[model samples]
Target: MRTKEAGAAMDSEFHVQCPYCGEELDIYLEPDVQGTLIQDCEVCCNPWKVEVWWDGDERSVAVSRGDGSE
Candidate 1:
């Protein structure tokens, strides 16, 4: 029998932190999204307003923060 794989090859969620409270949070990565992906904090419940710029050629993500409120 073929065993099931626990972790997938590509992770849908990326690790992040809250800009307001500095709390750890997870941001989902859309498969089709090849640009900035804004994210919010779950623990602190704050709007981080993140920006993830991804290079289509290099296939990399550069995360940043925007105007957000706690």
Candidate 2:
């Protein structure tokens, strides 16, 4: 039988602000690191397509409207 190990579960959070309402939000990204690209605002419910780029030592994140409309 498989047994669970201590500290094996994901335990990391990424905090970011909502693009529409500018509300701060914390999103858990331990298990879903790659899946954390796009996220919707909880307050305004706006769809934000996030892009994260890492250049060796530096990391950058950008958020923009999912739709083509400005």
Candidate with the greatest TM-score versus the true structure: 2
Task: For model 1, give the 10-residue run with minimal summed lDDT.
Answer: 1-10
Off by over 4 Å in 2: 1-12, 31-36, 57-59
lDDT of candidate 1 over 1-70, digit per residue (tens): 4444323216456676666677666667664565554555666554555554545532344444555333
**Predicted structure 2: lDDT:** 0.61
lDDT value, candidate 1, whole model: 0.54
Q: How does residue 34 of candidate 2 score in lDDT?
A: 43
Q: Which 10-residue window in model 2 sums to the lowest lDDT?
A: 5-14
Off by over 4 Å in 1: 1-11, 34-38, 56-70
The positional error of residue 69 in candidate 1, measured at the CA in angstroms, is 6.9
Instruction: Tell me the RMSD of model 1 versus the true structure.
Output: 5.4
Please, what is the whole-model Cα lDDT of each candidate in the order they appear?
Answer: 0.54, 0.61
